[model samples]
Target: MKPSLHAKIHLWIMALIILVGLGLIAQGGYMQAKAHFAQFLIERAFEQTLVDNQPHKPWSWADTHPVAKMRLLQHNAQGGQQPLGQDLYVLAGASGRNLAFGPSLMLAGAGVGEQGNMIIAGHRDSHFMRLQYVNVGDMIELYSATGQLQVYQITATQVVHETATEVLDQTESSKLTLITCYPFDQLAGNAEYRYIVEATPLV
Candidate 1:
């Protein structure tokens, strides 16, 4: 006996559904593998730029040594609260929360002593997500591998369009700027805005 037209249609529909499901799974796996490879590359680049030497004098930013990782802590400026930890990267021309630019990237510059803004940017998801919790008058501590510690107090916070360049400006004083995607809870598309936490050196 031959199958009816209705039965044939049902079989076709089931096959189509299975094919779609398989396609989605394959695409997901591909994305996962790609992300893993990208992370590996970033780590390798960070290791190559790690600095191991300390500066001879204090209160100086002249040494151009690179550090593998720097610890950033965000705390209340009143000196009575705990701080959040952030991963540090050394790169040039790095702004915003994008980190796929490659290794040897310096958000601003590397030195032991100098009065210049040492801007730092990290992803809102993995590296600097906690930045959203930072408030005005918060304290930020940047610890370098060379035993050099730079402290800054959060003086300002703002949400601006992703294209805004004012946040990346070079300042006369040694400053630190933290950048992350705005609207932390949003799940779709770019946030269209960036959250900036500006800190001035603690004297």
Candidate 2:
């Protein structure tokens, strides 16, 4: 039987919808692959930076370079802590582009291993997700470009409004302030509040 014009139009629309859906799925897969590849390159650059004792850009056009190495440790039953996972290479800037790659050091605060509060910001969904399990007494180790390691013990975890800039304030003491969006499990990003992890150097 010959198909009516209306039936043919519906068929075309359905075919078009399927094509669009497939395209979207393919694009998403491509994006994920690209992100993983980029991360691999960034890690390699960090290794080079450590060996050469210099900044190494992850990519040719990248504006940021690996500035430091960071690790988060979890408290064990014996009153000791063990490494949670792999060490994260800290980037130089806190710009969105840099944060997409890894935790970024905010230039507004003191430099790594320097006096005053050294602020580091990262996306909750990515590198800093482990910060959720971090509690007071857990330890954080930050290595400067010179491969100098500074150990800090977690002191406090606070939730503050995004407008609160006091966390970024310069202090007479050496402090490490880690910042991420609040509500770790929430799907909606750019939350009104921020999850802050404050740590002090271990003498």
Candidate 3:
């Protein structure tokens, strides 16, 4: 006996739905794996730069280069006062492409450790996620490609409008600014503000 026309239509609809669902899942998984692999390459370049004191690109085709090494110093939670954790590699120029992999120095600012504002920016979800936990007086170590090492202590954290360029204004004293999109957990299309962390050289 032949199956009814309605039964055949229902079976076809179910098959289509399952195919679409599987495609979505596969795409999501592929994107996640790609992101992780990119990060791994960036970190490897950062370590190589530290050894050679030269700009190192994460891949042969990559335009971004590692410019500095940064480390956050926080006291141990237990009995000891010594700081823990490893160093991070900072990339040159905070363009959208450069920032996707790691923190990047803004080319418009003064050189790192120079007598002006030196700005760095990172994605709130990745490299800069720990910035919110940074506290006043916490020391940050910056190792430049010129074999210069400097320590800066966090002085304040503030929220500013995305258009506010005052944070990038020149200063007589050396200052370092770390910037990230505000509302770290937001999934909105455009971020309206920025999270700013200001630090000054430790005398």
Candidate 4:
């Protein structure tokens, strides 16, 4: 049977909408898969850095190299750290480009494993997603390229306004400050607040 002109137009519009919806889904899937695998390459690069004692780029043409490795931990009965197995590769610089691949060390702050505050920043959705789960008494570890381990205990956490640059200030004692966009579950990347995790080295 021949369809009416109005019915043919309706069918065409519906087909176009379906195609657009499918395309969106496919793109989203691709991104999720990409993020899942990209971290493996960064992890591998970190291993080479440890062995070579030099900066090893996760991939050719990347401006950043793995500078340190971080792991979450819990305190055991003996007050020793029990690894949570949440390893993250810390990149050389905290620029937006570098943060896309992994949490990065802010160049303006103290060097990793140094005696001053070291600020690391990552996207709330990806590398820093687990940061939201950290507690005040939990332990965190950062291992340098030479395999030197620095242990710290989480001291505090707060949500600060986006303009609160004071959080990046240097501290009298060694500290680890992790920053991520606030409201972790929000779909917007440019939130007006930040989630800060402050940790002090364990004696």
> How does model 2 score by TM-score?
0.88
Pick out the ten consecutive residues of candidate 3 with the lowest summed lDDT: 79-88
lDDT of 2 by residue, 106-165 (tens): 999999878999999998888888899998999999988878899999999999999998
Using Cα atoms with residue i matched to residue i, what is each candidate's TM-score against the true structure? 0.59, 0.88, 0.81, 0.90
Instruction: Say which prediction, candidate 1 or candidate 3, comes out ahead on lDDT.
Output: 3
> Each prediction's Cα lDDT score?
0.60, 0.90, 0.83, 0.89
Shift of residue 116 alpha carbon in model 4, Å: 0.2
Count clashing residue pairs in model 1.
Answer: 17
lDDT of 4 at 64: 88
Backbone N/Cα/C clashes per model: 17, 0, 0, 0
lDDT, candidate 4, 48-165, per-residue tens: 9888888888889988888899998876779877776568889998988888888999989999878888999999888898888878999888998889999889999999999999
TM-score of 3: 0.81
- Positional deviation of residue 82's Cα in model 4 after best superposition, in angstroms: 6.5
lDDT-wise, the better of 1 and 2 is 2
Candidate 2: misplaced stretches above 4 Å?
2-7, 76-80
Ranked candidates (lDDT, high to low)? 2, 4, 3, 1
For residue 20, model 3's alpha carbon misses the true position, in angstroms, by 3.8
Q: Looking at model 2, report the run of 10 residues with the lowest lDDT sum.
A: 182-191
